[model samples]
Target: MVKNQPCIEIFEIFTAKRLHWVVKDKGESWTGQYFRDIILTERVFPFLKNEENVIDPDEVIFINDKAPCMRAY
Candidate 1:
């Protein structure tokens, strides 16, 4: 029953005012490096920079639930 299934992964980033997402390329794995490079550096940072008001990085807070792939060594 799995033969016709399409392979895709959805990644999302949300703020109080904005939401951003990307669909993974076929066969790409959701590794920690991928999260940092594609999700954080590519999508999230660009979105923050385009907002009308300036946002200080030091004042921002990030909360995570300790997902295995998201932990930093």
Candidate 2:
């Protein structure tokens, strides 16, 4: 951001049926403990558990994919 405005950062997850979004103030590092403790345990799991989502927690799977540009060349 320029001197007058704030910067924004976001993280997200999705499937054909739904989308989840996380917004954080700029420069917040998503360390492992923070990710496991807050993001998944507090946020995502709850979202998935919501009755409207009709999710079976046992069947959910997560995958992390690097951007093509970040892959070995």
Candidate 3:
């Protein structure tokens, strides 16, 4: 892994697969984070395109890990 770059652990990736979403055990391992209801991947392109520029749903990893919800345009 390169310095400062994020690396997804093998275990997290596997668990995320089973859950059908991206999983993140951030801050506390016991309490896991789930994202997108489904796995975070290229398929989420539509959702990302309509959303804010800074936050990308496809890039999102954890459930609780999120930015502003319900953008008012």
Off by over 4 Å in 1: 1-4, 52-58, 67-73
Root-mean-square deviation per candidate: 4.6, 7.1, 12.8
Candidate number with greatest TM-score: 2
Q: How close to the true structure is residue 72 of candidate 2, measured as C-alpha lDDT?
A: 11
Pairs with steric clashes in candidate 3: 34-63
Clashes of each: 0, 0, 1
Task: Give one digit per residue, the lDDT tens place, for model 1 in 7-57.
Answer: 767876666666767788677678989877976677666665554422554
- Residues 1-73 of candidate 2: C-alpha lDDT, one tens digit per residue: 4685765656687754688887753566678787767766777777666545535544565654553321111
Give the worst 10-residue stretch by lDDT in candidate 3. 10-19
The local distance difference test score of each candidate is 0.61, 0.61, 0.34
The C-alpha stretches of model 2 lying farther than 4 A from their native spots are: 1-6, 25-27, 66-73
Tell me the tens digit of each residue's lDDT in model 3 across 1-73.
5786765532232122233233344532432233332233332323334335324444443332365443222
Mark the 10 consecutive residues where model 1 has the least summed lDDT. Answer: 64-73
Indicate whether candidate 1 or candidate 2 has the larger TM-score: 2
